[model samples]
Target: MGIIDINKVTYEYIRRDEDGNVEGITTAVNGVSLNVKAGEFIAILGHNGSGKSTLAKHINALLVPEEGSVIVDGMDTADEDKTLSIRQTAGMVFQNPDNQIIGQIVEEDVGFGPENMGVPTKEIWERVEESLRTVGMYEYRKKSPNKLSGGQKQRVSIASVIAMHPKCIVFDEPTAMLDPKGRREVIRAARALNDVENITIILITHYMEEAIYADRIFVMEEGSVVMQGTPETVFSQVDMLKSYRLDVPEVTELAWELKKAGVPIKFPILTREELKEELIRLGKR
Candidate 1:
């Protein structure tokens, strides 16, 4: 089995009336099934209200599926007995670093997770060092989180999750609130975790540029996965992605427009470097 599996899963949020009667239901996830292999970087893309966040909560067992099942590392998340194990196997990071950080000191915040799990003091410090290093926050171990920049604080939050030694990490819009530099820092850290540490990463983001690094990209709309493929394959369908209310990477869009304008440019140019190379080659013709 994969590190994470969703089998025919569906979730609904029931709206209650003042009298506690069942008023209505909104389906957040509808029969979504996906498998994430060990040590792979996966990205989920969707606009607001597309159930990407709902699916992320399922990975961490924050919400149980109304129908079907979710399994993390072969343990069913719906099983009460495996709840803690599931959480330990898949740590979650939210969009806001302030919400995730608690300890007054940076090292203290990073060490909190392992300490809570009964790790020995010495081992906790070791983990704190390793985790902070993993996220490039080791130098700030003694600094206060309040004094750090938004990107630095987010890295600390990620280090906190890493200290728990989870096999998979679910990052739900971890860069949404940051500036360009902060966003790049968070994304680079996320990629490093997957490439160097071989950790399974599930990144949920609306930014098309962020999805370029993923091994596979899944596009969601109205609680269903409408598209799934490598970044190149998915971004090639510019019109289809536009129909789903999602944007492609800027360079890819430019290439698509060039093709439409009879420039004879091919599809799926993801970066400016790639586009420049292609244009140079075309000019030689």
Candidate 2:
């Protein structure tokens, strides 16, 4: 079985009136099924309110399924006994670093997860050091999170999650509030975690560029997965994605335009370098 599995999972949000009466229901996740193998880097993409965040919350057990099931590390999220274990197995990082960071000092902040899990004080420090180093934030261990740049603070937030030694990490638009450089830094850290640590990564992002590096991509719309494939395969369906109010990476769009103009450029050109090479080859012809 994959490290994370969603089997026909569905979740609904209940709207309540001020009088505490049940008003309405909105199905946020609709029968979404996916399997994420250990060490895989998966990207979830969609427009705002596409149910990506709701799906992510299921992986971390923040919200249990209203129907069907979500399993993390072979444990069902709906099992109350497994909730803590499920959360530990799949750590979560959110968009706002300011909200995640709790300690005055960077190292302390990183140590909080393991500390809460009843790890020995000495071992908590060890995890804090290792996690910070993993995210390239070890040198800033003594610094205050408030003093760091958005990128740096986000890295610290990632370090805090890593300190829990999770088998998988769910990032819910972690780079949303970051500048371009900050976004790059956070993405780099995520890549490093997947590559060097072999941690399964579930990244929910709106940025098409960020999805390029994923092993697989799942595009959601109206609480269901509308597309699922490798970056090349998914981005190749330009019209479909556009219909869903999503965009392709700039290079992919350029390639699509070139193809439409009868240049014979392939669909889903992911990077500038690849586009340059393709253009060079076409010029040689």
Candidate 3:
């Protein structure tokens, strides 16, 4: 079985009035189901309020499905006894690093997870060191989080999650609050975790460029997965994605435009390198 199995899950939010009376109900997730194999890098994309974040919460048990179930590493999220185990199996990193970082020093922040888990003090420090190194934040271990840049702080947040030693990490728009460079830094750390550590990565992002390296992509619209495929397959349909209020990566859009202008380049180009190589091949022809 896959590391995560979401079976026809549906979740709703109750809107209450000032008097605490029910106003209406809105479905955040609607009968969505998918699977993620161990060690796979998955990307979930959507506009705001598209239910992508809600779906991510279910994976980490931050929100339970009202009409379906979520299984993480064989533990049911709905089972109170298994909640802790499930959380340990799938750690989460949120968009804002300031909210997640609590310790005065970086290393202390990273060690909090394992320390809270009751790991021996020695092992906790060891885990803190390794996790920081994994995310390229080792040298900053002694620095205060407030002294770091947005990118650095985000990396520290990721290190904190890594120190927990979870088999999988769910990134819920982790780069949304950062600048372009910061976005790249966080995305690089995430890719390294999946490539070098072989950890399962579920990345929820609005950035099309970040989704290019994913093994698979799921695009959500109005609380449902409207499209899913490899980057090439999914981005090739630029028109379809636009209809869903999504845009393809910059290079992909350029390639699509070139193709429409009667160029012989590939229909769905992912990177600048791919576009250059295709142009060179066409020149030789």
Best by lDDT: 1
State the lDDT at 158 in candidate 3: 96
lDDT of 1 at 273: 91
For each candidate in turn, give its C-alpha RMSD to the true structure in angstroms.
Answer: 0.8, 0.9, 0.8
lDDT of 2 by residue, 1-285 (tens): 999989999899999999999999989999999999999999999999999989999998899998999989899999999999998999999999999999999998998889899999999989999999999999999999999999999999999999999999999999999999999999999999999999999999999999999999999999999999999999999999999999999999989998998888866699999999988988889
Model 3 superposed RMSD (Cα): 0.8
lDDT of 1 at 114: 90
- Model 2 residue runs over 4 Å out of place are none
lDDT of 2: 0.94
What is the C-alpha lDDT profile of model 3 across 15-106, one tens digit per residue? 99999999999899999999999999999999899999899999988999999899999998999899888888999999999999999999
lDDT of each: 0.95, 0.94, 0.94
Error of 2 at 30 (Å): 0.9
lDDT of 3: 0.94
User: Among all windows of ten consecutive residues in candidate 3, which has the lowest summed lDDT?
Assistant: 260-269
Model 2 Cα shift for residue 164 (angstroms)? 0.8
- Residue pairs of candidate 1 with colliding backbone atoms: none
lDDT of 1 by residue, 1-285 (tens): 899999999999999999999999999999999999999999999989999999999998999999999999999988999998899899999999999999999999998889889999999999999999999999999999999999999999999999999999999999999999999999999999999999999999999999999999999999999999999999998889999999999999999989999998877799989999999999999
